[model samples]
Target: MELLKLHLIALFLLPTSTLGFNKCNFPAIFNFGDSNSDTGGLSAAFGQAPPPNGATFFHSPSGRYCDGRLLIDFIAESVGLPYLDAFLDSMGTNFRHGCNFATAGSTIRRQNTTIWQSGYSPISLDVQYLQFSDFITRSQNFREKGVFQNLFPEEDYFSRALYTFDIGQNDLTAGYKLNMSTEEVKAYVPDVLGQLSHVIKLIYGQGGRTVWVHNTGPVGCLPYVMDRFLVTAAQIDKHGCSSPYNDVSQYFNLKLRELVLQLREELPAAAITYVDVYAVKYSLISQAKKLGFENPFVACCGHGGKYNYNRFIKCGSKTVVNGTETVLAVSCKDPSTRISWDGTHFTEAANRWIFDQVVGGAFSDPPVSLKFACNKMNTSQK
Candidate 1:
């Protein structure tokens, strides 16, 4: 872990040319996604992700589901922007740089059930787009009033900012939770991506130009999926992931890539990059030991179970055993050395590692670095 940290530190110190990129002076960033990129939308809307979640960096439950920063946070820092304050949050939010519309349980398509019913967010991707649209108009109005001009983004910032998306993971899991067959889940991917496409177009219509889209990761390797879902001995891969589930996730990503290509054709002014975080994440899980980590399937902050997880008692929830109160340890003693923070989200360390790999466009479709994402690339350039 120390070695990885040092390598990342050195990576940040290198020149722009060494990383195959030029600098882009992005004044702001607008993000829309699920928990993977959600800074605080879900936490503020529901309840804050209770303690140990932000222990690694924020030093408190800073409304994130993981131990520290998410990929969005890393991206923000790299681009010289402030961490996006959740749009739902009315607290000390600063929208001057940007706003985050992502919630923890958000999916691309709206679910039939409420948050309580399906454990999925009612604020789906469409709702997020609405929120974003509202933010633009409302914030502008508020700024015009001159009451909080400093708290809002400049009118031109929206058009100049980089837009990021890291959703669709929950959409895949939502189907599995409903006992849908893998084929059934795969069948509806087009519909899901259709909604995603609509939202991106909506953003583009609103003047969003540089778009960054991350494909979903390997859900099968997540402790939450492995513990909650049923997988036979043969179903588990050599890396201990559910092969069928991973296949479904990969299929979702493949279609998502196609959608990106389609969007590029439709939106001539937009520079869209489809990031393959799935490959980077899967490699990390399958080669955890070689990558300097422990069993990747185990939850670092969960209660006792095969994967140190219980769907009923989540990472921050408590349980009583033998009349003794026990809080599922908010964080493990060595969370920095682990991958899964609470059976679902990645650890701060893991998030950092993932950020390092993808920032250089190594895992991106256009193979254009994040700094130069505004320039549309030829697919054949790589």
Candidate 2:
């Protein structure tokens, strides 16, 4: 009788997430950020992501930087929603499941140089929000006009849809590129996060109630950072990643988490989930062998360097080899065993693995699964 009573108590103490009644019925997902989630914003504005970019799944350039799908693709699939169409992409677009406002090379704070000069996108975070603002009106107009009605989302979906953000990595790298020290980069994090919080408030003003924010990943482990930056032997961590860069990334995440907490108080109606992508990514890179992956720091597709990365000429760049025209930096025969596709981006396999790790809220603040991220937590999640 005592054993039966204890089992009943345990059953009653189960979290609400296990209950089907508490699961969110999010009809759509609106994503915003940089290349990590950029479906095709940059491609639509400039040009298509060339061949070998989406060779794994799409079998063609599907406007993503990775070899196949991204974490956003997995997130959408988890919720039974279709892949999000880029807001900037006008061709064959359907916004019924919301749109992606992310573009490669984007930064929270606008850069001083042009894309050609600094490799940063002209479309900053604020610009993306503006595009989103315009999209809200434009989609409604198209719906009312009785033209392209099927391509537009329902008017009420905006309020209930999950607003996801996975940016701020560029902001950290931008500072490093400008020759800023770790302390200098840390100094300006507040401003960068201020802009991020401002945008969240803007979304809140737009009646968005559910917000999902992914903290930046391990920037130190990226091949581009390792090859581009001069790192001393002592700076390399056990995983062969630059410790300084990763420290800066962790600091940025710390500040970002604080900002998210402050925003939670600032917007009582919103349920904001701060995802620790840094921890998840770092764990994968650190334990690559055990998890069945190659050297985590090496680029799967690149021309040269210890990391197989060349910043000047990226993947898919064309060159002449032995008097014949050839495509430079083609993908490896097997990308599933690799962690990085390009020097800067994760492979589809790595993305899928990362998604699997965090899908159950293992790395989320307030300890809520994506389905229940909208519910406000009264205490810190385990």
Candidate 3:
């Protein structure tokens, strides 16, 4: 454990692009998470996302809440894989590279609980695992029937794949909405991490070896949170975010980092790394002007509020606002110059920038790029 800690510390000090590091490539990628990383899982299941959500890049809603691709989409592209299909969209879907099981409102724990009543409930991390297990079973059956014909001739695909997790934000946000105090909301961290650890262990037990876990981002900086909780001047930070909410997010990220380290010691053969999404996102906010963001505090799409966000009006709703009778939640002329999209999600431009930094290694623990970490496992085995 001490050696591992020293190794990680040393890696952190190295340049983002360390010379001699191999680029990691994987046969498949299975992602599990909430909206931040969700591609189309929720859309496939609930049909809630539509139109202008994907207008910026896709020119239409492709199930992504953002105006274009997500971090996971960029990650897949970086690893040389096609866009992953949603796990729920199984009909005629190709699982050659893998499928995404992340839904917009999924939590680390089950979503049917009373606490998640106000949250979106399509499938949670627990349910995602069940779906993955079922996929494995189906794949095995197809192999026996010679349906795969050698495409997936062996079970090695599962062992050699990359398992990515980006969950828990919903858990934290939902609890906060229930009026839980900082301490009260934080009390759920251990259980959330415990459940996450269980999922990682389960994946390892079933042959997954490389896992990349993303710590939650700066939830307070999100337009939705700021508009909802920090409307008053005293409650807002200099960046127009909710200071208390950001503090809670930091606390969660700290605990998650510790959990990742512990997992490294416990699962010696598995390559588990934590991604500091909070720092990456906060940088965009703090350096908004330098990053080309004309406005970081306001949503790129929404209506009827100071932050360009209205909870009741939403990003695509049509409603009356302050005597304006047919006001619709409209998008900005140029989403590329903004950070937040629809009050909660990031714009595609923002996601692209974040992905570039993430793949560069600075945001990851062990200080190695994600591609390097994935390649390290294969190189060690060889």
Best by TM-score: 2
- Order the candidates by lDDT, highest first: 2, 1, 3
In candidate 1, which residue pairs get closer than 3 Å at backbone N, Cα or C atoms, i.e. clash?
A: none
lDDT of 2: 0.88
List the candidates' TM-scores in order.
0.93, 0.94, 0.89
Q: What overall lDDT goes with each candidate model?
A: 0.87, 0.88, 0.80
Ranking according to TM-score, highest score first:
2, 1, 3
How many clashes (backbone atoms < 3 Å, residues ≥3 apart in a chain or on different chains) does model 2 have?
A: 0
Q: How does candidate 1 score on lDDT?
A: 0.87
Candidate 2, residue 126: lDDT: 96
Q: Show the lowest summed lDDT stretch of 10 residues, model 2.
A: 1-10
Off by over 4 Å in 3: 1-12, 15-22, 112-117, 148-154, 318-327, 375-382
Model 1 scores worst on lDDT over the 10 consecutive residues at: 10-19
| Candidate topping lDDT | 2
Candidate 2: where is the Cα deviation over 4 Å? Answer: 1-21, 321-323
Cα lDDT tens digits, model 2, 167-277, are 999999998899999999999998999999999999899989999999999899898998888788999987788999999999999888898888988998988988888
Residue 114 of model 3 has an lDDT of 43
Error of 2 at 38 (Å): 0.6
